[model samples]
Target: MHTCAPPVETLEELLEAHPSINGNFGHLLLLQKDADDGTLSQALRPYFESAHLDARQAFHADIGIDLHPDAGDGDGPAVTYPGCLPLTTRKGLFGEVLAGLVTEGYPLVGEHEWCVPIFLFRYHEDARNYLFSLARRPERRRQTVGRLGSDFIGLLLDENGAVIRFIAGEAKWRKTLNQSAVDTVMLGDLIDDPAGGGARVRSGKGVWNDLNNDPPVPIGVRQLQRLLQEYDPDGYDAAILSLERALVVREPVPLPRTDLVIVAGNASATRDTLTCFLPFEGTPPEYTAGHDLQLVEVVLKKGEALIDAIYDSLWSENADA
Candidate 1:
């Protein structure tokens, strides 16, 4: 699997999509700006603590550690928070669900290790590209090591819930996932495949290195075509499949849901585009357009049973909305 972050600017947009967040939570770890801080926990502590209530909280939350680049030219810390769950176990009500999304057929786009939002479409930074490579730049380090800037950092899992990828995506979101977006996702997947995303993240042309020298095919154009052929026979389905494939591989699970649906992107594509091509859990999609966004609802037959245990735990603990 792979990993990436949501754009910084769109955090509000995402929060708005959720009923839980009547407005932004000051307790949430919103990026204060880019810096080369090495302590991801420091940046996230406030949010975690705000969400934490008692001892059993540990059962719901887990912490992870790793490293990334410095703010500018050096190295920094690579830390992770299972924000609410550990990456190693699948014992809780949501545990199997997290594992299944990571291990199975769908893409896990916009999900972080601790289940924080890591979708690339939530941020507004430009995708980093250099003359020789195509990868995002790591952050610069600050004198005092603490927290990461974006929520995209985390662990990724394969279909069996095995960690396959880990990364810190740039804080750039896209409104239109046109050719550039497709190319970006495809290239990221290729470079981060056999070799992890760490080596090439700061290097330009990591994936595009051979583009100028190799057989004149655009770096990921061919692979994109092949992926589309297999997962998407029709054009619209191809688009949804592309997005789904990228997200699932990166984060290794379906994105965290706000009221049971992934409401993150501002893509102009229709609900039918997603249902027709990249359907999940066997639910047919139904759409409702609001002034701010489009709402696509899918009815799951076993929905109540599947989430009953999870919700029951929440009720038992007196969890908040």
Candidate 2:
């Protein structure tokens, strides 16, 4: 689930934006699938097939999956062709990949030549552990959990190989973009009174809360540094050194940060195409950003079935005949 190299061409052809609304704070864009999903799904399939490339064996190789001498002896895939990832996991993954494509394809606030050098798919230990369950003789107990830090990260590097800007995002998918679901995620969940009669109040916990309180330097940057050092040391040598300088104890180099939030889901039958989960006016007061902010709302028709279809077809063409 790493690098699908940006510019997923079909995205441009498939999703049509409802007149972009520009404001003093940032831009708001609502993209909906062009009608005729049968054609749309076929067009979008290849990109996702590439996006969900089975990374189990490749990422785990460095983590000791290769120690078993029998590994790679057969020409067939060693891991699950398509392990049945939980519905939530699949939706979350789709959101991240969709956000990554948007991050790479769409223009940002200030400076925006973004590239996701490597996807941190290896960090998906839940997926990794799940694969292990099916691969071994006796199935291993599944580790049911979610990742801790950033949902997805992308960056822009300068000529000198120093990181100049970073894109950090939180992408979510819901079957319905109803008010309660939207409010609970973006703002915070309302708490009920113990006596069952008091007014409900926000819990002070949600996407906005997490974004506002993120550490100056994101946890993903450090994680990216480690992956770069391991996977492509020579290719990203200077990049690593630059990160080391920034990660140092005192007088660290400051990296400009950009935050993105994408909420994509099935559109309400009665909802207008222009309707969006995020505000269309000036930047929401919730964003305390010292850097840039981007928002995307992708509304689809029958998206769950499309997602399942696309994920099921990943790597299918390459099956051993």
Candidate 3:
């Protein structure tokens, strides 16, 4: 369990105070409170840009690779510019925002000491280019990779550096938050149980398999593995034991995992802006079974336009040049 108290007394206070875009897993009402004329954009721009840089570095670092300059001048490699607002860019931004929220101390899980969010994989053309150019993985050039896992994977750790749980996240930004939208964000059969005797015996393209297995673990998972091996090898064994014990604990045993859902859209009509509500209220039992869930809803006054506006403002210079 978290030993630290939350920074804000109430969810409303959290929405009003911090640059909410930079944080994770809570209700956020944009352009509603804090009546300052230009505060929102000013606060979000720097965080977004920095996060973009950090994400690129982290992704490369995960695969034991380094990025070289497109045109080196000897000072160092020039930053790789994501020149336009692609779908991947938007998805990456959402992951970074969620990570910021976790780093800023929003509890994504009830019984974990802290959650560290990582955005180390990309499933788009830009990432493919980076992988091929740097690692020489020509096979990955035309083949789709990195799409089989969660967008943001959070390492839920206890104070002793033992990973107690994992949070696999999926973020969606749309004008509507309806049933179809929720289904889409949930990633169809990816959330299904592999052992549950169905046509799909294999785990679909999702984080569940990655979290349960070794060798191919995500960057965040590897970090925890290293932490355990370095600090407490016994704790590592105990963690695995805990998971194994869950098999016989009950009929529907819960995995040491959580699902993080981030949904952003307009919500100006209702006065209740920062309330904790389940976005996947009517999701299928198979989709949500055996996992704890955390949801953060970002209600923008401008709705879907808010995302495009932020992207344009952040990338306009590069695009124009």
Query: What CA root-mean-square deviation does each model show from the true structure?
Result: 20.6, 3.8, 9.8
Model 1, range 215-285, lDDT digits (tens) per residue? 21121222323433443356334333433444553453432221112211233333233221112232222
Clashes of each: 44, 0, 2
The candidate maximizing lDDT is 2
| Predictions in order: lDDT | 0.26, 0.69, 0.44
On lDDT, who's better, 1 or 2? Answer: 2
Using lDDT as the yardstick, the better of models 2 and 3 is 2
> Residue 229, candidate 1: how far off, in angstroms?
48
Q: After superposition, how far is residue 255 of candidate 3 from its true place, in Å?
A: 7.5
Best TM-score among the predictions, by candidate number: 2
How does residue 60 of candidate 1 score in lDDT?
A: 22
Question: Residues 133-246, candidate 2, lDDT per residue (tens digit)?
Answer: 656643453435656788778878888776787888888888987667778888888897555678787776888888999987787888888878877898888888877877
Off by over 4 Å in 1: 1-151, 155-172, 188-265, 269-272, 275-321
TM-score of candidate 1 to 2 decimals: 0.19
> For model 3, how does the per-residue alpha-carbon lDDT over 120-159 read when each residue is reduced to its tens digit?
3433445545543545443332322333445555555565
